[model samples]
Target: MKATRQLHDLGQSLWLDNITRTLLDDGTLARYIEEDSITGLTSNPSIFDAAISGGDAYDAGIHAKSLMGMQGEALFTELALEDLRRAADLFQPVFESTGHVDGWVSMEVSPLLAADTAGSIAAARHIHHKGRRDNLFVKIPGTPEGVPAIEEAIFLGIPINVTLLFSCAQYEAVSEAYMRGIERRLQAGLDPRVGSVASLFISRWDVASNKQLPDELHNKLGIAVGQQTYRAYRQMLASARWQKLADAGAMPQRLLWASTGTKDPDASDTLYISAFAAPETINTMPEKTLHAFADHGELHGVMDVDGGDADAVLARISAAGVDIDQLALTLQREGAEAFVKSWHHLLDGIAEKARQLAGKSDGAVLK
Candidate 1:
């Protein structure tokens, strides 16, 4: 069997961390679902920015929207929704078969809203409603401000993918926010089966710390952090609070391993993918990483529920002067800023494309 299927059979979800019109139009996304067991997908400003600027795939859409007097964020949102809705439909079968736990497609709110709680909440609602698809998750960062917005979006029954998390504490914070949202729903006599996922980034930790560590610990920090976070995730599901919600029909907000693609050329391409192989969790991979895994990946044994030697590993790293806690905060802040940068680039790319298309027609330019 292909390693992708083997991994899927082991109960870890394999989701493509990309979306582009060509993937959909050429049936590549559907092929991944049917052949590679990719049950879900995710997109952010960076992904969209690349898609919009990298090719002619989005030029026609940009031109049409531009002609209709749409530009900037508004135009981009519509274009994103178009792709997500189609991808959502392609995954509908997996969605139905798994009873809504497996198949999902995520669309992030404007990254500029990462620190604006009210704006995050409003954008999530608007995007979720605009997509008009049940399996679409509106992504919100797990920033201090975004925590409250996550709770609100969940309570409002909008599926959420909490992004930009870099630590176990951050994961727990968003998990609590999700449960509070469910508890509120139960209080108001609403359905408690809202879907959510706490996405903890993995590879970024290693990227940030590798240079400071000894060679022995080079690519190990990210895996250790993942192990620690997985332990917390298991404990959270076993907690009395979660059990009560489970009994009340609330779904456990799943723990997702994001940024699983290896960043270092010296490391194995599937390093993060093979390391984080546990049930009821997700590993979203870049397109190159996904294809690499399918080609030659091996399933290591499942992750340790007790976190293995994660604490010990973390201790050693801390002793090496890494200041793990402070670094987590820095990574989260930097991640949010990076997304905002991508968001601006996406809008600018759209406007530039619109101008190019307009000049081709009538010597006009988009504002």
Candidate 2:
């Protein structure tokens, strides 16, 4: 069997962390669902920026939206929703079969609002409303400011994908927010089955800490972090708080593994995918990583629910002069800033495209 199929059979969801108009128009996304067992997808400013600028696939859409007086975030949202709605439909079967736990496509709110609780909540609602799909998750960063927004959005019953998490603490904070929202909903006589996921980023941990550690410890920090976080995830699900919510028909907000693509060329391309094999969790990989895994990825077994040697590995990493807690905060901040940068680049690219298309229609070449 293909490793992808094997992994899926083991109960870990394999999601493609990418979306582009070309992927949809060329039927690549559908093919992934049918062949590689990809049940979901995710997109952020960086992904959309690359998609919009890398090809002419979005030119006609950009041009059309420009004619309709849409630009910037508004224009991008429309284009993103169009693709997500289509992708959501493609994964509808997996979504239904899994009882709405497997197939989900995520669209992030504007990264500029990462620190604005009100704006994040409003954007999430607006996007979810515009998306018009049940399986769509409006991604909100799990920053301090975003935590309240996450809770509020969940209380409002908006399916949320909490992004930019880097540690077990961060994961716990967001998970608490999700439960609080569900608890609030139950108290207020609302449905408790709001879909959500706490996305814990991997690979970046090793990327940030590898240079400070020895050769033996290189490329190990991320998996260690993942193990530790997964341990917390298991513990949370077993907690009375979660069990009460589960008894009330609330779904456990799943723990998702993001940034699974290996950043170091010296490492195996499928390093993160092979390591993060566990049931009821998700691993969203770059398209290249997805293909590479389907081709040659190996799954030994599921992760250690007790965290294995994660604490030891982390301790060694700390003894090597890395402050794990401080690094987590720094990574979350840096991740937010990086997304903001990509968000700007994405908007600027769209504006430029609109201008170029306008010039062409007027029979003048844009310089």
Candidate 3:
């Protein structure tokens, strides 16, 4: 069996962490689902920025929207929804078969609202409704401010993909918010089955601490963090608190591994993919990493529920003078900033494309 199929059989869902008009239009996304076992996809400001600025795939759409007087972030959201709605349709089978747990396409709320609790909540609700697809998740950062927004959106029955979480504590914070939202729903006589995922960003831990580590400690921090977070996730799912909600029909907010692509060229390309494999969890990998894993990835074993060696690895990093707690905060902040940067660049690309297309139309009309 191919490694992708093996991973699926072993109980992990492989989702492509990319979406481009070209990928969807050229049937590549569908081929991945049919051939490589990729059941879902995810997109962010960075991915969309690359897709819009890197190719002409979006030119016609941008032109049409431009003629309709749509520009900036509004224009970008429409273009993204166009792709996500199509991608969601492609994954509809997996979604149905899994009872809505497996196939999901995530679209992030505006990164500009990462620190604005009310703003984030409002944006998430708007985006989720705009997509108009039950399988679509509005991604909100697991920032301090975003936690409240997450709770609100969940209570409003918005499926969420909690992004930018870097530690077990962060994951737990968002998980609690999800539970609270579900509990609120139950109290209000609403359905408690609001689907959500707490996205733990891997790979960045290694990138942030790689230079400070001894050679033995290199490339190990991220997996260690993942192990710790997964331990928390499993425990949370089994707790009495979660059991009560489950009895009330609430779904557990799944633990999703994001940023799984290896960063160091010297390391194994599938390092994160293999190390973080576990059942009932989702691994969203960049297309490059996805293809690399589909070709040669191995599932030696799933991650230890007890967080094997996670404490030891983390201790060593702490002894190496890296404050894990402080680092987590820094990474989350940096990630939010990076997203905002990507958001601005995405809008810039859209504006420029709209201008170029408008210029062409004017020229043609003159002729």
lDDT of residue 282 for candidate 1: 93
Where does candidate 3 have its weakest 10-residue lDDT segment?
A: 293-302
**Model 3 bad stretches (over 4 Å):** none
Worst 10 residues of 1 by lDDT: 358-367
Which wins on lDDT, candidate 1 or candidate 3? 1
Clashing pairs in 1: none
lDDT, candidate 1, 1-367, per-residue tens: 9999988999989999999999999989889988899999999999999998999999889989998999998999999999999999998998999889989999999888887999999999899889999999999999999999999999999999999999999998999899999999999999998899989999999999999999999988989999999999999999999999999888889999999999999999999999999999999999999999999999879999999999999999999989999999999999999998999888888888898898887754333
Candidate 3 to truth, TM:
0.99
Clashes per candidate (backbone, < 3 Å): 0, 0, 0
The model with the greatest TM-score is 3
Candidate 3: pairs in clash: none
The order by descending lDDT is 2, 1, 3
* Tens-digit lDDT string for candidate 3 (1-367): 9989888888888899999988988899989999999998888999999988998999999999988988888888999999999999999999999989989999999999999999998888889879989999999999999999999999999999999999999999999999999999999999998889989999999999999999999998999999999999999989999999999888889899999999999999999999988999999999999989988888878899999999999999999989999999999999999999999989987898889889999999999
**For model 2, the run of ten residues with the poorest summed lDDT:** 358-367
**Stronger candidate by lDDT (1 vs 2):** 2
lDDT of 2 by residue, 1-367 (tens): 9999998998889999999988998999989999999999999999999999998999999999999999988999999999999999998998999899989999999999988999999999999899999999999999999999999999999999999999999999999999999999999999999999999999999989989899999999999999999999999999998899899899999999999999999999999998999999999999999999999989878899999999999999999999999999999999999999999999999999999998897785433
Evaluate model 2: give its TM-score. Answer: 0.98
